[model samples]
Target chain A: MIALSINWHAEDQAWLLVAQNRRGLPFGIGGSQLVAGGALLALSAPMAGRVASWAAVNPHDPTPLLRPPAWDDAVVAAAILGAALLLALLSRWTERLGLRTMLEMRSEEGREPLVGPVSVTLGPDRATIRGATWEASYDAALLTGIEEPPGYLILRFGAARPVMLPRRDLTEPDAAAVRDWAAGVLGHDDAAP
Target chain B: MNEVSSGTPPRRPWERPVTPPSARPAGLWTSPAPDRGPVLVVRVDTEDEVAASRLAVAAMTPRGGLGSAALGGLVMLTAVTAVLASGSGWKSPVPEGLPLLAILAAIAAFAGLGWLAGAYLLPLVRRWASVAHARRVLRPGPDGVPPDGGGPARVVLGTRALHWTGPRAARRFDVALLRGLVEDRDHMMLRFGLVSVVVLPRRDLAPEQQEAVRDWVRRHAREGRA
Candidate 1:
């Protein structure tokens, strides 16, 4: 388990979720996405340069493009375009899957990324989050695994990704108790991994 | 005088004229401070000292909501243009520009942009002007006197003493006396006791100058509470 920094803020959980959600979106889907798209487009720049050179040499030939090894050029152009589209779609799909997994795990763990203070209650087979703005409960049996990463407590509930909770809000004594509690509850289930 | 009287008078129009040495102004005082550093050093004549200091403090006056106001105006302009472009049979605001009124709408949108620029950007320019004015007023000319000489006083800020030199002068105010720093409209007030000095824009100050002020006030603020 990584020791949490004293300067950390509890509300950082909201920002972490936001960052995670942003990460789930593929490159070229929002701001700064254009850089990746532009790089992909540049891959075809050499072919474009060749086309420009060919057109300049055959200025009088209106059908210069048609005069080329037509089938090969068409196939190459189509393949490049197809590759670009396929990559973009794949990126978008993976991001969405990651976002879904995070959200699902968050729901199962009965935690939410919000600004207000949060309190928790854990029993033999259930967990509850009492937030200033919201309250939620979850079946503790759904907790599949727990990862005690540095500065964070991540709980996995049958999702590809886990729900992260920053440990900044917890005092040293409280952190130790929570750590012990998690170790006991997840001890049997986490044994598989 | 002899050349003029002896008819060796002014040469050809192409020739330059010799002028007498200009007499320097009296009672002018220039501070012994260095102005080439990161610190904002202003040398004001004793007479203009207070007003000039006020103007300097005014420079720190924060202009609030300028960004939001500009953005809102831009969004409104875009919405108006989009509406005008659609030609959705909406009545023309400036009826004579045409039945379509697109050109008139564009003109009106541009006018709104102009207004936004004037309202938000002009104050920023004015704040810089105040800083420049203070700097010029404070910088002593070759004669060991401020160019805009009026008094014998000098105030050197962002310096070792944060010194003010003159009669009845509070020569130095320890950073510990820095009670608070705040902005009021177009002027920033640096409070000490119940008094505050207006100063220039924070952006106009060199990074070191800004940091010096920040460190001074912040350290003092923490100490004062203790």
Candidate 2:
């Protein structure tokens, strides 16, 4: 099992996570923007579709007799494409807005941290986040289907937003513990850290 | 350890007393017992649903709040467009006066409206309705059993199966086959095949009752809890 401790690096404006699992994969995360950007990128396709459909059904002139069907289809296609681009832009803007909201919520005159250090303890089929206002214990089974990207570990607990942990933040011991923990959840017989 | 904080506090009156074989009481807690055996029942009432629903929605979305944020932005844009279209002559910028922009704006406006309704309005109404139903169901009526309508909507965790009963529908699944458990501060979700049951933390219960349920869930719901 890997053992690690993490501290909020205020000067760098990032979380300084140290793990001890040399065999664990290295990824980068810790900032809210990283997760927010990734999530928005994932939803871009569906958002585009929705935007396009909306543009098609909404007519500036309520009287449909004013426009030809062929012209409407073309307009709709353009609208869909345009909506997607606009939404992509809007997603970034909102992400910034959300980050700002989170920071403001935590800052004391933009100085004191609202969220304290978070301690994670991983055991057999269980993981617990302690010393945070939103402290919780989860059944690690919920993460069975999570796909680990090359460097990132996505820890999802049902109904809560998944927390993306960058493997880069972990040390060899931490990585080993994580790999062992993930192996159990993922049901793999041969995962070495 | 500090002497002030070292020892446990005295137990409260409402709390179930711990006893040996000679001091055991006939009924320590009065919660309904599942067929398998007596387990702490977390009876979910109507209050605190908006917050709970938010947790459920967060789980269903791919990236957590991205979906909601996008929808919210779209709603704001459409609302502005709707207002502009109504006042000034808002026309489509596209060729042939297809009214493309107006149509798009209208669509955005309506979709945004619908999202808001589903996210907020519908849940509020359901919460109100459930509270109303529970009132009548728990009322001192002729029969002690719940009114002819199904029992107050609850997620019952039995030793073998997990059951959910609403006013009109009921569902149960073997606990052993449950796929996963996801929980945040506001809600706990149990997933089966494709469906999920969202169980909210009961705030209305006495402190002891709530603790009992939490202890029970920590043991039964989480894997490898002995």
Score each candidate by Cα lDDT.
Answer: 0.41, 0.42
Write the residue-wise lDDT of candidate 1 on B44-107 in tens digits: 3422433434443343244444543454344334444444465532443424434334433433
Each model's Cα RMSD = 27.6, 17.6
| Two-chain complex of model 2, DockQ on C-alpha atoms against the true structure | 0.04
Cα RMSD, model 1:
27.6
Please give the clash total of every predicted structure, in order: 18, 23
The DockQ value obtained for model 1 is: 0.01
Best lDDT among the predictions, by candidate number = 2
True contacts kept of each: 0.00, 0.07
